[model samples]
Target chain A: MSNNEHVKVPANLMRRFADDPEQADLEVFGRRSDGDRRGFLRGAGLATMGAMLGAAIPFNRNMPAGFVPEALAQKAMTVDGKDGLTVLNDRPVNAETPPHLLDDDVTPTARHFIRNNGIPPENTSADGWSLTVDGLVNNPMTLSIADLKSKFEVVTERLVVECGGNGRAFFDPPAKGNQWSLGAVACSEWTGVRYSDVLKAAGVKDNVIYTAHVGADSHLSGKDGKLAISRGVPIEKAMNPHNLIAFAMNGKELHPMNGAPLRLVVPGWPGSCSQKWLKRVWLRDVVHDGPKMTGKAYRVPKYPVEAGQKVPKGDFEIIQAMPVKSLITTPQTGIKMSGRSMKVGGHAWAGDGKVSKVDVSIDFGATWQSADLSDPANPYAWQRFGAGITFPMAGYYEVWARATDSEGRSQPFGIAWNPKGYLNNSMHRISVYVS
Target chain B: MMQRLLPHLFVLVLLGAILLAPGRPAWADEDELGGIPRAPGAEETYYLCSACHSFRLVAQQGLSYESWKETLVWMIEEQDMSTPEPEERELITKYLAKFYGRDRLARKLAKQQ
Candidate 1:
């Protein structure tokens, strides 16, 4: 039969069958005309059909005559293991929390954004998982979860982990990676032993200058032994007491998408530095040349480049502490209010410094008023800020948030253009209509 | 012109289906080319690029032809992608630049503003 002659199956029904064949109504397949079904089966056998679907049909025998499987149903764009996230890409599974859903001070694990560069490792259970600390170490060691717990002092702290490419969607030329908006960040409570403790236990050599982190996630190309991503930080950053080899989030075992059983939580820097599904920590004498470390994977232009400027490879530098940024979590955009007065609140953080202030403006940056900023629960935790703003009159207004770091650096009015579109900490604005 | 390319595109799609058959169940619907409008090289572009990452990643960008060519070169050199024939490379670049070209940048900026 010609391709056009094949009966079209609805994508949702195909997804239902793929997700749970047992729950599927086999009679639906039987409803098709016998002649067409026979022709389809004869033209492309059950094996070929299954191959086209990318898996063997578990209940192929039960599939009655005249059944035609549609093109492999695209996995439903909605994420299976997340809550209320806007999926950008489903293949390597990158989703972001909408600003409305990110209202909680301590972000719920389910609401946290999922950013995966590679397919998550299948065997995420703690039973057989082990972490090896080697390279430039006087005493290389491998430790299990139990051993890690018994040997080191376990600590829990609320820390913010933001993607390096957060707000990339605002880039004018459009970045090459996931077009993350404002929600690729979350401040969650993580429990684990400090990374410094682990490295010290391994007896770091004096010559070690950088750390290379490896994870179990497989590369997208299905290449054997090829890592999905391997990024690291400088030795000084790795040894920061606030950094942790986190195994738990929000008082529970880490979610598989967030790196179950074991992961790194190097807060304040790019989230890529905190490798998920962590397998090894290798100390290196020189900069770690991992899959994403070299070239322009997570780096930005050393100096600011114009929107369409061509940047040479040597001019790019790795992003360290994220620039000062803030997000308005409550009173989501497009909200309509009857009164002139409104309460606005959100969270703010600086990469290596504390958020000194977060100012709110309703007149499109014409004037600014300081919001009451709260102290962080712990180092690296985001500070909550809120303010009561009284509008002059009923009209459409935009609330813009600009956060300043302890060093007095503040968010810019526009995105600082770069080739890779990393580190876009422009001031965030939301729309509100008042009558 | 499209009619001539259809047969070759079908063969490539069939090969992709067969090559991808033995692995894990398809996580993504292979037939659903997100945001990639039908064009001369749509099938070939979908089959080749979707072999690794989502076509949505490609659809998100709006770059000049030179930038798109540089991306393809980067893929071959750094991303372990096999280099395509010169003609095939040109075809893919032309298709990408035509659909996801500099105009997309203007549309995105307007939408955001």
Candidate 2:
């Protein structure tokens, strides 16, 4: 912001990256114009939440700075691994059930949530790095690590990225996609070069409405040896200033799992649009539809389906912004509360839209009251909401939260179950206790 | 946007198809409770087991036999591979080399169609 506080990296800059026939020079993040090379990254806003309290985050051991400890801010606690109540993945514990519900305005990186496609990538660095900007462009170029830094103007924004499969495990009937438990989402202050800069460099053409992006890590390949990553966004969404080509988080370098060197930051969208380990950006007018693109994943039934019905391919559309929803962080379901004033907090988010109002219900939707919403500062950022309720009487309080967006879109209570547990906007609920 | 995708919905065929896969190419054998092990030894176990590492889209991989073999070696060195019995290893090798082997596409497709 200049002395006038004018919007610097204005929101519409993303439009410049669209399929414009006139291509501009693309710049990567981290270059200081005066011969210093920077990489793509989001700066300011929320501090980067890398690192954790108890365990070590391998692969991304060496990180740059500006990463606030919100991601890593947590009272360290490691459970006894012998307990069968654990799901083992990357490390002994990829995720855990917090002893108490969380109410912190910011989700600590350690307690954020754990969802992995495969083991997190290690040993990735800014050196030997290059971002490939191609497809539907006049100039397709492979930008060297330094090329991205030295050339582009850098800006920062804070937004939340939630996996489409978030909250999938709670679905009534199991679905095909990863049945991710609640913690698959995280918010970050992404700092990076503008997608517009890169798009300008690549020189977008007319008649393009969408762009497809692929990641670096390829697991078991599909037929023809296609890599395992997949994702895309409408030209409109990508052009939103909130949409970022992030190179840094919380002021430091990126971890491999989070897409070091570069990643997309599509505000109000699911993790799908923010492809990690980002390698290539294809600026095509055609919609993406490989197995990773349009096939078999990140889709929801286009309309409501009967409960317990299996989702067929045709009944759904790609999941974009999350529904108006909130999570009760404290007194997590099954928590015991004393006969006193208890502070309750959780997170509320609306996809591509602003979270306008949040209401909390203690008695399983019997009644509702407004909850305090956090000033995310940025429209695309997650709002930390809270409420204080006295448990005068308590047996089992089915606590839940509902949110409404600036567009007047509120979360529905228990959306119909689909085959692949896609966007579940059901009112966020957690059961608690009063002794 | 109320777009009628019923024309594009593959439910009619797929709903009927999912239930009838018992006799298909990927059918599980009932006689052997453990069925036939796909690969044998530490290296083979990684190939057979890690192929379906996790159900996550990022985790699902349909690896070829050759790559699977290479992956097993890497896993053993990078990721720890537990050792197994010799005879069990032989059974796994026979089954995997025959079923998941590079040339098994012909037999698998014939069974499916």
Query: What's each prediction's TM-score?
Result: 0.81, 0.63
Tell me the tens digit of each residue's lDDT in model 1 across A158-259: 999999998887877777778888899999999999999999999999999999999999988888998879999999999999999999999999999899
* Candidate 1 ranges beyond 4 A from true positions: A1-76, B1-35, B105-113
- For residues A1-435, could you state the per-residue lDDT of candidate 2 as single tens digits? 112111112111222223220121021111111122121122211111110111122222233222212222122223332121213242212443342423444433333344444434454687877778888889989986568778887887767777776656555534434445565666667788777777877888887778888776544422234455567887777777667788887677765556677777786777767777777888877877743566346777787787556557566687767776677666656667677567777777888777888888887788888889877768777888888876657577777788888899888876557756677777767777677
Docking class of 2: incorrect
TM-score of predicted chain B versus true chain B for each candidate:
0.64, 0.34
* Candidate 1, position A350, lDDT: 93
For residue A203, give model 1's deviation from the true position in Å.
Answer: 0.7
